[model samples]
Target: MPADRDVLLSARDLHKAYQLGRVDVSVLRGASLEVGRGEFLAVMGRSGSGKSTLLHVIGALDPPDRGSVTLDGQDVFRMPPRGRERIRNRDIGFVFQFYHLLPELNLLENVLVPGMVGRSLTAWVRQRRGLRRKAIELLEKLGLEHRLQHRPRELSGGERQRVAIARALLNEPRLLLADEPTGNLDRASGKAILDHLVELNDGGQTIVMVTHDADVAALAHRCVHLKEGQVTSRHDPRDAERPVQSVSRR
Candidate 1:
């Protein structure tokens, strides 16, 4: 941990398991981590290593059986259901391997989904213009300005993933959680998506990404490896004689 950076998210003694018939499979055992503000951290592990589970626990999407997750100084697991949902919606943004855009909605409409949550149709109608502008701004920033009216089925795989990224940024979240975000794309497409994420991180959007690809992990400020549900090693790329890029103002 750097002395100058503030810890934005922290997890301690996380443990999770599942029942399979008469057997219990433990996915995480005393896993702990700290992510600083504006940092890009990569969690890498083999299949069934509980990498995704850790991300879910920290992002408030799922709870750990025994552990504590603090986000921006708030104990996430201690919050009520509604409070947890609020944190998940307004503070943390998630991007998954599969582009989960609604097939029935256009790109712009899908991007507006987060903003419309918990709002009545009448209330949404009242604020629709501002929400639409925000969505348009996000899509434009993601290079999907011309495809705002296009449905998910009409776009290429890379384009669809871009739309998903735009949707994740619709709320200007404090932290972005990505689970194998480029798992479904080809090498070229994956690199493109990662480049976009790197750019975002450079601009002070904190990101925690889970990836199996070593090349992708190299782009992050730090990489932590997990094995059999425990953090095995932590590596800082800047310590390997690589120049550290200055983070830009958001």
Candidate 2:
């Protein structure tokens, strides 16, 4: 969280649990965080620290067992089912490590998925042209202009990840939540992805990225460590401001 900017996202005393067979697994226990407007923050933790679960709850993808998540000024959990779905579609953008692109769809079509969701056929027809232009611009900006007609299977790992990012930005979301965005990429590819993320943050796109690697997390403006189901540390690495990621290969 940046100290001088307005708060854009806030999670207060969050608690989330999962029922695994007969066992009750508590994932988040009173975890709280705040992100300033246009801030890029990273959450770093080991496996099973519930970083992904926290992102889902805040992004309206999953409901928390207790507590609340507020985006801008609206309470996320208090919204109706349709409203929350709308939030997921229009308010928050998600970039996953796996690059969840539909294999059958081409790059151009894949980027347009968010705009087509929750729209009537008539509405889609009316808005498709503008959305198409926006998608083209995003893809081109991400250096995918030549691959617009290509399917996911035809692209490289970095190229596929770029398509995922373009799709996430199609709706012009208020918050972008990335889960292990560089986890599956090679060192060079991972650094390239981080560079794009840095460029987005510079353009005032508020982002919350989750990663286990400290070097990858250092790319953010501020880093928080989630330990034992809660955020227990906060630091800003003013030294490593460049997009150089020295992540270890797993």
lDDT of each: 0.85, 0.88
TM-score of each candidate?
A: 0.90, 0.92
Local error of candidate 2 at 204, Å? 0.5
- Please provide, for model 2 over 1-250, each residue's C-alpha lDDT reduced to its tens digit, 9 standing for 90 to 100: 4463498888989998899999999999999999899888888877788989999998989888898898878898897888888889998999998999999999999999999997789989999999999999999999999999999999989999999999999999999999999999999999989999999998999999999877888678777877767885543343234432532221
Clashing residue pairs in candidate 1 (N, C-alpha, C atoms within 3 angstroms): none
Off by over 4 Å in 1: 120-123, 234-250
Q: Which candidate number maximizes lDDT?
A: 2
Residue 135 Cα positional deviation in candidate 2, in Å, after optimal superposition: 0.4
In TM-score terms, candidate 1 sits at 0.90
Q: Per-residue alpha-carbon lDDT of model 1 for 1-250, expressed as tens digits?
A: 6443499998888999988999999999999888999899888887678888888899998899998999888999998898888889889989988988899999998999998985679988998898899999989988899988899999988888989888888778999999999999998888889999999998899999998777777788887877767775544453234423322222
What lDDT does candidate 1 reach at residue 120? 71
Top candidate, metric TM-score: 2
